[model samples]
Target: MRAGHCAPGWNVTSMKDIEHPIPVRIAYVGGGSLNWAPTLMADLAHDTRLDAEVRLYDLDPAAAERNARMGGRYAEVSNGTPARYRAVPSPREALEGADVVVVSILPGRFDDMAQDIGIPARYGIPQAVGDTVGPGGFVRAMRAIPMLAEIARAIGEHAPNAWVCNLTNPMSVLTGALHAAFPGIRAWGECHEVTKIRRQVAGIANADAGSDRWSFRDVEVNVLGINHFTFVDAISLGGRDMLPAYRAFAAANASGVNETVPGEDAEHDRYFGSKCLVKFDLYDRFGIPGAAGDRHLAEFLPVGDYLADPGRWGFGLTPVEYRTRDQARRRARAEALAAGEIAPVAKRSDEALIDQIVALAGGGTFVSNVNLPNRGQLAGIPEGAIVETNALFSGLGITPLVAGHLPEGLHDIIADHAARQSALLQAVMAGEGGALFPLFHEDPLVRHMPETEARRMFGEMIAATSAWLPENLKGAA
Candidate 1:
């Protein structure tokens, strides 16, 4: 992290030798994204170790070029090392000789996302974040899978050996789609939800036990289940068990109302904020800690808990109108940064993208939680279904650690999601959109509704989002 230091890795010396310098090429899909692109551009500017040439590809060439200009501004403004950034027109051109590919894209317009949430709301379903689960996530997956598969095919044709790290929501299904389209592709999905949990656990343990030299990075866990619904069975710090302290903390806070998190500002208009009230509530029920935020966890549970009236709970539901307005705000910010009218932020994200890439490049072995095919890493989840677990990343290849099983109380809820994701994947790949009703009807929010009403809502949702859906999927129900 220091100036002039090589990126943190093992067994590498003089990675930045001026003579005969080794080049690291990274392909960034969805490079036009204002949400993630700026974060990556800033993170890359400070990472002196991997001075990569990042070629960006996006559906909108103009947005991508704007981001490229922002990256150039980073190089001009920073006193530290900065990665080179450029915009390319096609996926193949961006990925032709890349060492790693990062994916974070919006599947459809914000208008389509509005339908994804609004139609479900009319049917009495509650969703805190619609893109991860509920009826919204199911339909969103239908639109996202095929597009992700096309990107997968390009990676196969161009950079077959590249390691892929998908950051898209509906992450499990889309990561599976990548492998399904290209069986030989090395792909995994990364999320920071678990990182949030680890930080919370470290704080609680330190307060209770007066722990010896512990930080979020020192907290070790055995991760299980899939993305957004992930759980941790065991946690330790400095080889000492911290579950007892966590149990006491959960017991005290499980039955209370939380309006603000410990470190976040309460006065700001927060679209994504939580105080872990829902996570503690789940812990009280299943005796296992939920790793994702309360808002994301609420969507996977029964409607009454967190979503029926979201504002009454700690985490409020993010409205579509707010998101629509925020797009223009983000665009304005992007324009200012791109034009050098404002200085770009240089702080790095806590995300694991750069660490994963460095490890995959034979820099060293790095272990972290990754969403991969279930090859016995998670028991009871079907094989080849994308599941999140601890894995070792090294020059040898990705080797998933055996993460045991889901608790019996949570077995049905987690396993059924895995099954539904598989069914959705098959339906999308075959373009059999009408075949999805059975799974759609059985989703948690829809199962309790009258059969006729559920079907009607399903049809209306399809009709509403048809602008971005393919012909085969448009109102096929």
Candidate 2:
């Protein structure tokens, strides 16, 4: 609602727009996605520039229908000429001749994710957000790769020219699999982990961090490493290096001591959580500012009981209860919207997917963290292995910036995982399900435990998830 925020269908006329309104067809692969679909719908409703159509497809018909209704309702209410939204039953129907394809699907059920987190915990290898790295990350890739390959093939046949912007978990691996599956597809993984960190940095420097409500355009940064495990190697504000100031703040807050006013404890303090004490610890050790939150960074840290009690690393476990609560909240929201008690609220969001699409279509430029093949952007990682780094998106294509080299200490950790990630992708694509076990053998957490125990736990997890595992992996054990 605020001025300067990208409005639904931003009508600003560029040379391209002046010539004729571009017809954009976006296919939402997981159109029933409870979290991401709605926000994207709202963004589309706010934009006034393009003549757009959004086709929603999902495994759950009712979920997709709900989103289609909500999306259409938002467009009707926003009073802006928004993208027409419709629910379709199949990927082929959704993806046919689309200009941009947004993939954000959960390959399996929520129960499977619970098993991913819980099975690892039984062995004392704790994971906070297990979708990205560690045993959970590898196993998740096993389940997700096949589904993604299917989507890639669908796109190749139906929307071959559409730009694929994946917002899925195990981002690097999933996105990498899509690239490998369809070598000619233009695809990249989009994540908000690094974006949130950028906002936090802006707050620390007293600089403007752009928001959906308020636009604060200029913020420059340099990033490196794989997803979940990334770092802000350089940050500048108005041509001034802000790293020293940011580091100074981190150093001062290293102890994470709370100074509360009489009777008011830290738990009652709303602003206490902003200081990332664990990341600062990493800064001291690795000499670069950590990009992700402590919860994600905890998975890769070489410390004891850090996974079991993430509190040991200054964070808490992401229990299954959290997901239960989230599901309940989503159901309630859906019900309320259906009953007309709540109308869709239209506002700009910080997500960069739509912005990237608009930029690519309108000949504008968009810069954000994108996951793609390394290709010398990171000297430490393999050339074609997926790596998350800063890049510029334009009509021509996404050009990853030269991030040079990661620090040797950090490089050693990322390189090890990157190699394993490559092996996991190869194994899954080749249907060599048994080969996945050795990749687990090299896992940092599994490496800490006894080999026999680790193998047993790994096999147990594989067996537990057999229902959803690809045909190749289903009977491997």
Candidate 3:
């Protein structure tokens, strides 16, 4: 990796230094998560600065137990990074006395997610990724909001002083739910869409300098807007402006990415793939960098703009069937790993979870783009509405940095979603769907359709995912 690409202004020592490795308890709400939970296990095993005891809890007790065993094995083989793992029977038991609570859960099964996308597509409305916005996102929020609220309530009762890091979808709504249900909860939503920009910038920095790879940590960005619809106005590396280089990169890749972006491999591109065609397109059109991946960004804009024909833009809607297949494949792999049929690998994730934890636990200061209630950090969004913007994480607490108002058009675009997300959070919090129809009817993706058709589509989407939804919402439209 290129020099100076490591953590910027990183303190070599913190309250808990190398020798001490302060002990902390992390309550993982979705401990059975095939993807994120393992990543966290590896991260904890790879870090020697803090001792982490992770309690895994999931609806599938057996899956959680499997992960617990895998985590124990992972820690044992990591040259001893100081950690422990266990599977808890309930959310409260897992959360009690925890120093940090991680919430990363699937609201329902893969089939449920399929319905989230399929029903909308039946209306000739295509969504590249349904977990964030569009009709699929709203339906997801319907269940996820209540589920997260329940988690938040448990945290309030069991780990009142713990820091919460949410990694669920419909990010804005879910994160807002935490605050809405328990206003005193210390929580923020973590998403990696903005990190993609930093990684791209790192690649550009490396290529421009004619050196080895540069760590994404070297790049600093100014983020604005909501989770899936975030934007980066400025990027800097080593006290040098990198936007010009980024602008050039965007221009070159605007039509199609002719080369592999830094760490990407063509063979592995399907499960997580994007040439950032949407990002480049946004830069070309709006004079701003779209921070989220093409699939996610497509859902936020007018449906016809990208989702209508995503393939034409060099990104295709990842079929739900593919995710289902991938999950099954991953499940098998996880079983093998947990059964000790294969060696458990320990590699730190590029995500900022560990760093954020360290920073929050009196480790040091770090900055990253995260979903938090707007506190004047984003200009056009209302205070207390969840918005994604850069924030400083340190011992004192999370402090959102100023992300000035966007151009009127951009501001209005982002503000519209922010308002909708906040409104949805309220509706879900109160367990009421009175405003659901209006919110669905007004979404950028649904607004273009005739009112009657939009209402029909909305009702069908709601009914498709109604099993977990509250009684008042099963027939919302």
Candidate 4:
């Protein structure tokens, strides 16, 4: 078969075919992102396979311009070809006739994010990484959903055929809001949590973490549930069932190997300390392997216990200083690249976004976890709710692989939360102030507290973020 040819659900194409590939037009919604923008540029450069015309759009025009210049320099200095890069002023200009749209925006900066974390802390709710779930996610949804809705409307008007790929945090909520705003829009959320879990599972099989020692193409793992709180029910390696061995390893931490993920170098000293223990604990207690980092997993636990001793869960309150330092590092790297003092490096990333685009646009098949509307892939979760599950991307379109059922306890937990997320989106969209309180009340962290306390906390958070929130939600307290 030819490079762009595939057999129904099977895709057997090689990189050699990508030598002279079709050109894909990509529009980046938050192109100024210092954190993700550079890595994405490097990935596109290394692919060297598929050609692309890239449009950079950002609220900060200067940042987008800098990225465009950086990409141009990278293309000039690199050994292989990269996408054609340009910075456009408006989202409409960027989205016009584009093939794919990538969204990676921080709706508000660190000061706003600080309110998402800090205000909730006053009410005795402690969040390790407040970007995803809990009080932090709820308030963030308030500020981000409206902005994302506008972006979705623009995509609908300017580039209806474009595939919307969101890499924003509060992953499930943000992605859900997009679909809620623009139903029938082709979209999905890409997260690195499952990829990290896959690497750890691969390490357990004695497979090289960074190599194709065991190809991802040869393995099948049933990943289901919400983003960051996902669970893997089964894993098959090379047509052999490795679930038992994996389960044993999870129960015993038998690998005894440091997973060595990014941002984990500071805690590299502890044996099982640097590693993920809460995930293993979930597998032992719930019979479903936890698939995200412990930092994320800790969010779903009761607030008081985690607040009492966060170190037990392998995380701490992520200070704003960390964000400041990260921004400085990105700025320094950009300055060095522009000054021609340091050469641009092109390396393949574990991020499957590029692979997904190539597979969908180039007529190949790629299997990976994606967040999309649930259409029977996971049992017990509402059918239309956005879910994270194993999906096959190809010319046939993105198809979810059916994951039969989650353990009853885990299913109940996920189903309840998924439903709440769905309801929360609706309430936020409709500006229904009364409906918002119960959603926060039901949150895993705040649920243990009295309804009055939850209400007070919700009101305080809303007030703290009044400058960015909707009129109905701003002072609903």
Among all candidates shown, the one with the greatest TM-score: 3
Clashes of each: 1, 11, 0, 0
Q: Could you give candidate 2's per-residue lDDT for residues 300-407 as a string of tens digits? A: 765363555544445655666666666678767865664567988777676777667876786566677789998888886888999988777668788777776888
**Alpha carbon deviation, residue 390, candidate 1 (Å):** 1.3
Model 3 lDDT tens row, 1-477: 111222363212233455567678999999999989888888887877778889999999999999998887788767546578899999988998999999999998888899888988888888877998888898898979989999999999999899999999989999999999889999999987776787788888898889965777667777888998988887777778888999888877656763233454554475357767877888877889888777888888888788777767777677888888778887997888888898876777777888888888888777777889988888868899999887778889987878777766878888888889889888877767778888987888988989899888887777778889888777677
lDDT tens digits by residue: candidate 4, 41-125 = 8788787656778899999998888888888777764445567789999999999999999999997778878888888888878
Q: What residue pairs clash in candidate 1, if any at all?
A: 7-49
Best prediction by lDDT: 3
- For residue 369, model 4's alpha carbon misses the true position, in angstroms, by 0.2
Task: Tell how far residue 446 is off in model 4, in angstroms.
Answer: 0.4
Q: Residue-wise lDDT of candidate 1 within 1-477, one digit each (tens)?
A: 111111232112223333322368989999998888887777777665566788989999999999999889887755355678899999988999998898889999888888889988887896877997789998899889889999999999999998898999899999999999999999999888888677877777677668644557667777888889888888776557778877787777755434343443543236677767788878878889888888888888778767887665677777888887777888999999999899986666767676567666666666678899999889998899999988877767787878888888787899998898888898888888778888888877778888889889989988877776788888567
Full candidate order by lDDT, most accurate first: 3, 1, 4, 2
Query: What is the lDDT, from 0 to 100, of the residue 282 in candidate 3?
Result: 82
Instruction: Report the alpha-carbon TM-score of model 1 versus the true structure.
Output: 0.91
Tell me each candidate's TM-score: 0.91, 0.89, 0.95, 0.91
Output the worst ten-in-a-row residue range by lDDT, candidate 4.
1-10
lDDT of 2 at 208: 34
Per-residue lDDT value at 99 in model 2:
92
Global lDDT scores for all candidate models: 0.80, 0.75, 0.82, 0.76
